[model samples]
Target: MKRPTPADACEVSTMGKMEKVPTGIPGFDEAIGGGFTPGTVVLVAGNPGSGKTTFAAKFVYEGAKRFGEPGVYISLHEPREEFYMYMKDLGMDFRELEERRVFKYIELLPPLGTESIDVLADKLVKAVVSLNAKRVVIDSITPFIRELGEAKARTLIRNVLKTISKGLGAVTLLIAELPYGAQVIGLGIEEFMVDAVVVLYQRRGKAWTIPVRYLEIRKMRGRPVEQVVYQFVIGPPEGFTVLNPVPLEVRANVDYRELLKTYISELDEVLGGGLYRGSVTLLQGHVGTGKTLLSLIIAAENAMRGKKVLYISFEEPTEQLQQTLETLSYPVDKLRPYLQILFVDPKSITPSAIVSKFVRRDTLPDLVIFDGISSIRRVIGRELYVHTIRDLCKILKAYGITTIFTTDEKPGKDPAVSAIADNIIWLRFRKVKRGLVRTLMVLKNKLRWSDPIEYLLYFSDRKLHLRKLEV
Candidate 1:
């Protein structure tokens, strides 16, 4: 073949510099600015069982299968047959790939005495060139270094990288084994020779809880990595995949901002014109003090306004709530279209169940009323109840859904619910000459410009009367 001229050589180098060698692992390529640079040597360093081999295999397999670039996988410890069967188990189908001449698996054992390191390096380069391979993976170089000493091993690796970069121009992955507690990476010197270094580690989370697999890009030549540490999982049928980072803010997909009316003028007036969208209101009162009644009234009024409402009852059964609404003269027939009633036995409900139902509902509601959180707090332990209530409020608020939670007041107030609630309303009944007199008190209102005060609560002729504002 005739040697190319200076202009042709410049064009070729420019093209090679512009292109990237993408790894098939999801989120990995994006972390390294689309992929590895062409003709670059990448060192994947990890402890035993840290998914080093699986990652290298997936990298080459994806190149062959998706990018139409042939690859060679050279192993020193893993046998050729075992490597084939193992990759097959992971759905790589390396046998078929080999048959199609897209993949080549080679195993070279240690004690390479008779043959010189330069000769072996030449043989590997020839294999890549002969097969027209564009990608290569060696799992790994530790055993080879053990057989050829550090100095000779370093020289041999430099020659191999030169052969691939200058002769074949193939992107290569060199796996390096590090001891469990080794401070240095991959014989310590290879880091300087390679263009990139990635470490797979088992990182313990939250007070040394069980470890999770994580990938850290320690160095990437000429590329900037946004997130250094990324969570990854190695499972069969997909091989190795890097997981995306968790979202910083949980945003609602549908952005609804209008407040659903509670239909109580004075109550709504004290609540900054109306209850704000995505606000959680806690209704606390003793038995017969109208906590449940207030929740039902809000739900009924919101539903009557053509807004979808989900009413969850822990105390009253669905039939009993319907009958009570009928006795209270609420238009149950008109409200049925816009309301969904779910009667859950508090003992049978768990935090997970409530979160799933609220987050994954088929028809998401504009407003939700959890009538009788006291029962939930009692059934689920206090700690679990607090956690679940907090999570539920977060999900509801994130989804822009107005929430009403009713709980019976105890002698000493529990700050658990109030801490997460955006609005707090307290109901109390005082005995007087005219039977029992009910009063409503506003303890907290997160809405802008809302007056927090107490008022006499009187209900008659399907309307609520807030009279004699005090305190």
Candidate 2:
């Protein structure tokens, strides 16, 4: 029996009952639910240097090259040569498409638009009709609004939506810029008139803070799109591709304990059969608490067992991580072949980017560690950290790999990373009546119940031991 489609699923897409356009961007299509629906106008908005023009133009180029759909890019800012040249740097091969007649360009500035473009909406509409173009990209609609005010921009966008989408059956993308701190809602008209509205935003700071690229769909005329913070990075030739996101299934039942096991066996045993294989484990504590040391033990042990291990350090350099491991007398020299120590300080190449580097499911490592969690707290915040960790646990669990992470918990504020872990182990300084000693505690356990809520943990001259202590 044919099942009825849910009412909410209607605006999620308009590509027929089961049709989907495969533009082939790495992860972009999936975030917006799927590719653009036929007869849909998608607005791509972003700040300057946010790769706005580069991303939109490239999408149209892909439609021409991959799907064999003829495309046209209308530039409101630069002339044809400049527009084509600008994208060339980002690796868009528009010249070849133009030669093949599969692509064309039209610049609508005063010089190219002889008559006023605002009053000549038909001229722009005619170009798309004559080219028989199925894909159209207007470089930017911000300046084009110069000739037309808010009311006129609204009417013009409405007309363009009707002509290209309904008349020409074209999948058009309108580009616009967004000012910071201000909620620019696609001229408010484009959002209502278009089938899909995609917003591109730029954020600056450290590498982690250096926002790669983010896309949000405010409206999808009638189609489904996932609402997730996607790492949208457009590499040289490919243009815009989202990082491989964690599959939906992994988010719910990730086993964090099993991942803890791949790091340290004793810790695993204490953790009761290791972290839940698919759950995220947050290892956070105070300063000088040996978070980094704990990670080394997990990495070296996993490598000794012939399982691959990856240790990423944001605060500590690679050389520093290795030097610190030597103090633990870890068998780092033995499993050097199987262990991978990646030193990444840049913010843009985030935890999610690690997923892009580990696609080889055929031989995925058995254990992964994000050593010293506190240091990375600011790089990828608590909220995003949860999402990334949730997705990470699912992917690692699907491959049966274990992961261990460490974070710093301030004195009073609860640790931000604790909730996501399957098992949470903490290390902090505790002063006993006799002396001040570093303590380790089983704050939370998603794996199995553990006895002795708190324990006296001490490490001296390469030896680590724990003793039962009063909480």
Candidate 3:
């Protein structure tokens, strides 16, 4: 190659600065300084469904379509057919690209807990050199590490990233799935070796409350990226789409006082005139503890009073809910004229996805009740259960929606329930010295104080009524 003149060198440098590639992922290219700089390494880490593979495919797809840059996808976990199966639903044509000699797909068979990292590195290098790849993706960095063992794997990861950058001269997209809630910046030797890191997380909430989806990215090479979290989702036509953040005003400051007033007059007075506008009240008790009945009373009464309300009943089916409420003297028909009830059956939708899709943009209800928060929670898993509740509270409070949640407790034991709810409404049936009786107690109210401490509530004549406790 001949050395260029000063003018030619200047032109080359300017063009290099102007050259940009779309990563095929939404919000990702923008996060990585217009696109990966030539020979830069980007580490993308997430739990499953975090779009690790799909994101890499997007990068390859955009390289071909936008820059006419040939790319390669190396798979260690699955074969080429498997890659196609996962990407096909997302409108990817990897097989066609392979046939056209524009893109190459390679799969390596590495044992999960017993693979040699040095051998792995050799395979990676050979693939890059042969393809003359301009862009590259490693579908997963997991199996390689698992096979090589922990300490040795770290060394291999570092060397692979360093060698790839120096010899291949390609922008690298390394796919990784870390355990839940792990830090994004450091992953063995690879963390320190990468130029940028992005962590994607999914949050959830009770009933119609929408969980805002976003990601956190840490730039190691001074990439132009905003620190603010941005909403994202995996949808059709566009695989990963990013949405604008919800305006602060639209998400918070509810009126609990009005909500309490809207309920039965005595219940309102018992609750010190009203619950705050934007507050979360949890109904806690054991099975058959009147959780559904209490929700029915609130939903039916509010609906009857011309207030918009949404009821997501997890334990009871729609018809089953109607029949049970009818048996308890709360008929949906009698209350139909006063209020509107929208049932979000959990059988079809996950609680977290519901909040992201429905709670944020749908009807701004005066009250929203997630009958039995435990049902939605069972799907979130044990590790993330606490954080899930906290995020839910934030989203609901921002929307200013008077929210209520139900927790079915075990008999005679209060197991860390207060940590999750803003207000704890404990409903119990206990045998006192006098006799066996039902009890409803307002235990913890985050917004304000209440005086009526305990009240005797009744379900009679197809209606829920209240009376002062006979002590």
- How many residue pairs clash per model? 0, 33, 16
lDDT per prediction? 0.75, 0.66, 0.64
TM-score of 2: 0.67
| TM-score quality measure for candidate 1 | 0.55
Q: Which portions of model 3 show Cα errors greater than 4 Å? A: 1-51, 57-194, 197-219, 223-252, 256-262, 272-274, 303-319, 325-366, 374-387, 410-422, 430-437, 444-449
Better of 1 and 3 by TM-score: 1
All candidates: CA RMSD in angstroms?
Answer: 12.1, 7.0, 12.1
lDDT (tens digit, per residue) of candidate 3 on 358-401: 33343566677777667655655544444455555666666676
Q: Can you tell me which runs of candidate 1 are displaced by over 4 Å? A: 1-17, 88-91, 114-119, 204-210, 246-254, 257-471
Over the stretch 63-86, how does candidate 1's per-residue lDDT look in tens digits?
888888899988878898898888
Could you estimate the TM-score for every candidate? 0.55, 0.67, 0.53
Q: Please report how far candidate 1 places residue 59 from its true position, in Å.
A: 0.7
* Cα lDDT, model 2, residue 329: 69
Of the candidates numbered 1 and 3, which has the greater lDDT value?
1
